[model samples]
Target: MKITVTEDQAPLDYDQDQVAQQYQEAKQQLWRSRIEEPSLMRLIGDLRGKRVIDAACGEGYFTRRLRQAGAAEVVGFDISERMIELARSQEAHDPLGIAYRVEDARTVVPQQSFDLVVSAWLLVHAQTREELQEFCDGIASRLRPGGRFVTLTTNPDVYFFRPRPDYRKYGFEMTLAEHVKGGAPIRFTMHLEKADLEIVNYYLPLTEYQEAFRRAGFRDFQLHPLHLAPDPAGRDDRADWEDFLKNPIMILFDCVKAE
Candidate 1:
């Protein structure tokens, strides 16, 4: 007997459950490490008691952190329902009152503005600069006058220069150049582990990011360098650590609305 395969099958869209699981595993591997916690905690220290909007609060990793930092109110938004479900589950046990919702960061209109709006690695998955700009504008709109907005993104310099073996000889349908240049409006692809193997990430040009903040009404902006260690262990080699420190890896933009 011969079996026939159906042609009506459809490809699955983005799976929130799978994405949540990926985030859970990824955060455990990345954020749970001690090497990066100090920098993250130090950043959160200044946000204490502020009403915060966590624009892309995946799995509530940083949302819980914000609560621990004493944020008066923390509202989290994400496009993934499963992630939001997990976040909500996490919030139920917290002494701090944190709220998590499934919503698109691209179309954010908060009922009330916040004192600080913070997002981590949001633009990594976005397909266009326009999406990035819109995300920034959404954050700006959700902030009170003189409110602060911050984001952490991979540095483009590290990305565009890195070579991808998968694309080179594997016969991947699209080349890096085509992925970046062929898409309408010009887009970039995340090389993921191939580029920054340890972490799944994407990059945006430093200059373009600076200008994006300016366009979004952030009067002052700054990009701080983030250096990563190889073994997830504290750097013992001062020179290697120093070299990574000197090299641009990721950018953390801290800004405040001008108007």
Candidate 2:
């Protein structure tokens, strides 16, 4: 299936070097370093000898980690040219043997099937139902039968039901208009040390997400909550992380292609 975007449906750009750099830095922030990465890696457990694709792989951060986790082959794809360039530069510097390409997740043409397809913060970019379905279809096309797809995305429940300004403590803020529905635009701002980065994502109800997955031939879908990385000091609870835990901004979706 071919997925094309109309003029008004164009994707948000991270083609600027500064934006790409800020995005890479944002990954090192507490929420991502502690909650997102560890939980996502755990969900995608044991990739030894598997072929993996990191769709919408901004700067190839997780792509490198996927390779290190024993995937025989790993490829990173992103729509942003600057992001891909940064990822390729990192590969050149570290010699990870990973390949990086510029491609949109909603309309990607995979060269070969993969054992796993992983994305971080990709699905939220879909501005319409058709685009959301295209994203799912593109992912399904990249995977072999029974291959798994795992992604981290905005938790709609929290975004809609528990919207709050307290997220500033975690170095970011989310703003949404009242009575938001599917396809409503969401404003996400990251307060970095030196600068603030803002990006837009669209809201789609959970039901819509499930429908799209089914239409894309995925089954056994599951939603996994984010887990805070274990404290090195062996402390069970971290007071600072309590609010974020109660109202997590992100969650994981795990599903498999139907045979």
Candidate 3:
């Protein structure tokens, strides 16, 4: 959907939503599990009987999951009208009691503060550190005092170190080994190699993120490397994956709003 923007504000185009949906559609994956399972499962497990907000919740796929996980109330907010429409359409059958709304991440005011807020892959494409801080401010604003915020983003170390290419390309041999991972064919084709596509990502260091959270009145924050080991002994060639888990392409932030 075309985002409405005034001269003073930047366009919060739902381009990310469209590209993500298109990629997922091409890959046939309903949601990204491998990347999401580690932190989300950890975050949701603590959310039973609590009010939860799924910020930047594209399509409400995981929003429905939050309801299933026993949240007292689940509200999924995204900036894309089409995404919200489609999410609602999918929930028309049983309606998992999750509400989906179209609202800008930077400006939308929550109906009420929530006990737990989770934003996934929303900060990866940020153009600068300030934008990431703005996102942090937004998350901080929607939390109840002493509430927790869980967000996932591209690993700054890995994102900054990835090789860059000057030309467009496609196709690569993926090994579940080394620092590189096989980009599984999902609704979209995300290559294992970084240089093939133009990625506008902010390499916001951990210290910078921590300071931003501090300024937002969040303390006692922890950064966990979002690395998952493949089923051990089940896959023989998984030793490389074990080592790769030391450093991953994603990072999860678990923080608490000061009381």
Q: What is the lDDT of residue 236 in candidate 3?
A: 53
Q: Per-residue lDDT of 117-179 in model 2, one digit per residue for the tens?
A: 999999988867898999999999899989999999887775555436478888887777566
Candidate 3's TM-score: 0.72
lDDT (tens digit, per residue) of candidate 1 on 132-249:
7887777777888888877765556543544422321111111223333211121222223222112233345566667777888888786554534445454565443443345334
Model 3 is weakest, by summed lDDT over 10 consecutive residues, at 180-189
TM values, all candidates: 0.72, 0.92, 0.72
Ranked candidates, highest TM-score first: 2, 3, 1
- Candidate 3 scores a C-alpha RMSD against the true structure in Å of 7.9
Report RMSD for candidate 2. 4.9
Overlapping backbone residue pairs in candidate 1 total: 1
Considering lDDT, which of the candidate structures 2 and 3 is the better prediction for this target?
A: 2
Each model's lDDT: 0.60, 0.84, 0.62
Candidate 1, residue 52: how far the Cα is off, in Å? 0.8
Candidate 3 per-residue lDDT over residues 87-198, each given as its tens digit? 7887897688888888767762554478998887777545556766787788888888899888877665653333532111222111121333222111112343222222
Candidate 3 residues lying further than 4 Å off, grouped into runs, are: 1-20, 26-31, 108-111, 159-199, 227-237, 240-244
